[model samples]
Structures are given as structure tokens and as C-alpha cells.
Target: MATIASQIILHPVVSQGLKFGGTTLGRDKTYRALQYFSRFFAWYLINKGDKIEAARWSALKAHLGTARKLMRLGKPMEHLQAALRAAFSSSPALETITTIARQLGYFGYLSYDAIVWASTIKLINVTKETAARVQKRAFQFWVAGIAFSLIHGALKSLRLAKESKALKASKTWGEKDLAEEASRETRVAQITAARNSNNAQLALDIFDVWIPASGAGLVNLSEGTLGIAGLISSLLGAKAQWQSVNGKK
Candidate 1:
């Protein structure tokens, strides 16, 4: 990525006909530095609260100030021209910095229960509201996963049993033929059950691990969306479990 940045900084002749208050800042090495400084300054203004952002801005400003002093510029135009050149030239760097800052900010702002759960299952120990919310979400994911598995398992088992009975009735089968058909059906049923279980496990991992870790940041979707989804899945899973329990009774 740094190599990419260097390539862009060197190759792109972004600085063209650049003038600040009638003072020409020609496209050259100095001009590129000036551009970088200016762009960094703008980025600082946009993301000023963070300590790192402030420190970087201060360093960049000081460098530009030092350059100004060395140039012995009495006119404001000379300083303005230099600053403008830096701002325009440093766009690539500024964009990269901004993106990184945003990701860091998002990480700090969000709660991730997966980490907490991995460390320990004691959700009550986590005091933060965000942590609590994340724990609830994780639990919902588990419940949903279970609910789907139970309901799906029951339905699929019933379906296979019915199909087996039908096959037996349709065939004038000897004991050996009936036994072979039953074995084949059992194998099919086992494979299907395993596949469905794996699917449920995948769903659980997505909601519990993937979403909390990084997926949330990548999508930039509202946290409320996850909350709503968690709620629905929890309900479905609970209902399925309840029905299964009642059916067994």
C-alpha cells in the first residue's frame, strides 16, 4: 500500500496550472510536498478530534512553516501558493489517512461481543451498554440457529420417512431389496441432516462471529438492522423449540 502511495504521488501529474493568488507554484518536487501538506491539513480539519490526527496535522503544519521561513516570503500569496500546492498534491495520502481514521473510529465506537464471548461466557460481567447489546445479539444468533435446526430436522426426517414408506409400498420387494432401500434412504437422510446442520452453524457464525468482528464495519449498515434481525431470529428459534418440546410431550 505504501508502494502504491509512492507510485501515485510520483507518477500522477495532478498539479497543473496551479496558482494561488497569482503566485505560481509549479509542478515539481517542492510543489508535491506542498500539495501533500495542504491535503493533510484539510484531512486534519475534517478529523481533528483524535490525538493522532492532531499530532500529524501539527507536524505537517510545522514543516510548512519551516519551509515558509526558509523561503523568506514577505507576501501572503507566496505562503498561500505553497499551501495550496501541498493541499492539491497530497490528495492520495489524505484519502488513505481518512479511510484508516474512519475504520479506527468505527472500531472504537462499536461493541463486539464475539471477543468477550471468546474470552468468557459471563455476559453479566461486561458493564458497557454496547457489550451487553452484543451479548444479547450473540445469544439470539445461537437461539435462531437451534430453532432452524430443530424445525428443519423434524420436517426433513418426516419427509424422508414418508418417502421411504412410499418406496416400500410401490415396490414388490423381497427382504433383501427392502433392506437395501432402507439403508440407501438412511444414508441420504444422514447426509441431508449433516448439510442442514452445517448451514445452521454457518448462520450462527455469521451473526455471532463475523458480524461483530468486521462485517458490521464493512457494510456500514445501521446497528439497528442487526438488532432487528437478531430479534426476529430469536423469536423464530424460540417458537420452533417450543413446538418441538410440545410435540414430544
Candidate 2:
């Protein structure tokens, strides 16, 4: 039977719902909620042993601006996929990596909101007050989003590399040693799972206690509340999976 994590990753209703609800709330809230949920969703997919899907999903989420630009430029989205595949090849050449990185750089430069704001200023007349505050906010949003994407990608890559190295090292052990190592790893995993369960319970408890005090101060309380609830739900779901793995009730 498929695991709950697998079901969630494959269906993605929870993530999609959060995105839709967040967008309805406000642009700022939408991206904030999305940035958080993407991390959670990526974790869920990885837990389900769908690391490739997780990576692709992470890439897509990080490159929405690139997607938008592809639409504007009449380029197919598959082009980016091909570029990424080539860039990530086991024996990728320096030129291939450079090309992909350059493309990403160009996309970031052209589609960034700061550049868009400047273009808008040149093409359309607006009050000075509107230009100063509103456009500046737009520029900030784009820069922050790009920075977040870079950091997220870098961290995920590092984690994957470490895991790969560990797996490769394990392969060098003899059969008996490998079996013993696997058993040891399994026990450690169980302890880790139990710890995760405790952490999740603590998080849910704190969220429940804090919601009443914090909810009143939030702008767009209903939407914000939904976003928070969604985040808590995902945490609880992961906790449940960990508990199940560890044979905990």
C-alpha cells in the first residue's frame, strides 16, 4: 500500500489548496505562505522516497518567474527542464553548467520586479508617491524571492550530496557489515522518528495555545488563520507518519 506521504505528494490537493487560499488573501501573504508550504511539501515528498519529484517540484516553485518569462518569450517550459537535466548530468561539461546558470541569471535579471517597475515607470505615468512606495515594494519582493530561492536550492543540494556520499560509502562494506550497519541505522531511525513525533506534538500544542492570542492581531485574519492551520496540518501529518514508522500509537 502506498504511504500517506506518497498519497499527499502525488495528489497535492493540500498544497494546491493552500496556494489558492493564500493567493485570495493577498500577494504578500500568498508568497509567504507558499514559501513555507514549499519547504513542507518538499520534506513530505522526500519522506515518501520521491526525491526526484521533490527536487523537480522545488525547482518549479523556485522558478515561477522563469515560467512567466518563458510564456512571455514564447519558449517551452521543457527547455528549462532540458537545461536542468544537462546541467545535472553525471559528467556535465563546464560550458553546459555555465550556460544553464547564465540562463537563470538572465531570467532573474529581466523578470525581477525592480526591472519591471522601472519599465512601468518609463511606459506609464504615475504619481510620485505611488512610484516611490509601491514600486519600491515590488522591487523588494522580487529580490527577496530570488534570494530565498537561491538559499533553498543550495541547502537542498548540500543535503542530497551528503546523503549520496553516505550511501556510496556504505556500499564498500562487506555483506555482514552491511547487514549490521543496516540494523544499526534502523534503530537510530526509530529513535529519530520518536523524537520527531514528540516535536510535532509540542508544535501542535504551542500552535493551539498561541492561536487565540495571536489571531486577533493578524491582518486578513481568516486567510492568515487558514494558512497557519494548513501549516500545522502538514506538520501533524509528518508527525503521524514518523509515529507510524516507529510503531507508536
Q: Which candidate is the best by TM-score?
A: 1
Q: What is the TM-score of each candidate against the true structure?
A: 0.28, 0.24
Clashing pairs in 2: none
lDDT of 2: 0.48
- List the candidate 1 regions with Cα displacement exceeding 4 Å: 1-175, 204-211, 214-219, 247-249
Q: Number of the top candidate by lDDT? A: 2
The RMSD of every model to the true structure, in order and in angstroms, is 26.4, 20.1
Candidate 2 residue 125 Cα shift, in angstroms, is: 1.9
- Please give, for residues 1-249, the per-residue lDDT of candidate 2 as tens digits: 579778887675555454444432233234433544665576668778999988875765455433333334422234356558757766325435544553454344334444344444365566776655554454343333334334434444444455545655665457868877787577556645544444554454444332322322322334335435545644564445433444456
Q: Report the Cα lDDT for candidate 1.
A: 0.43
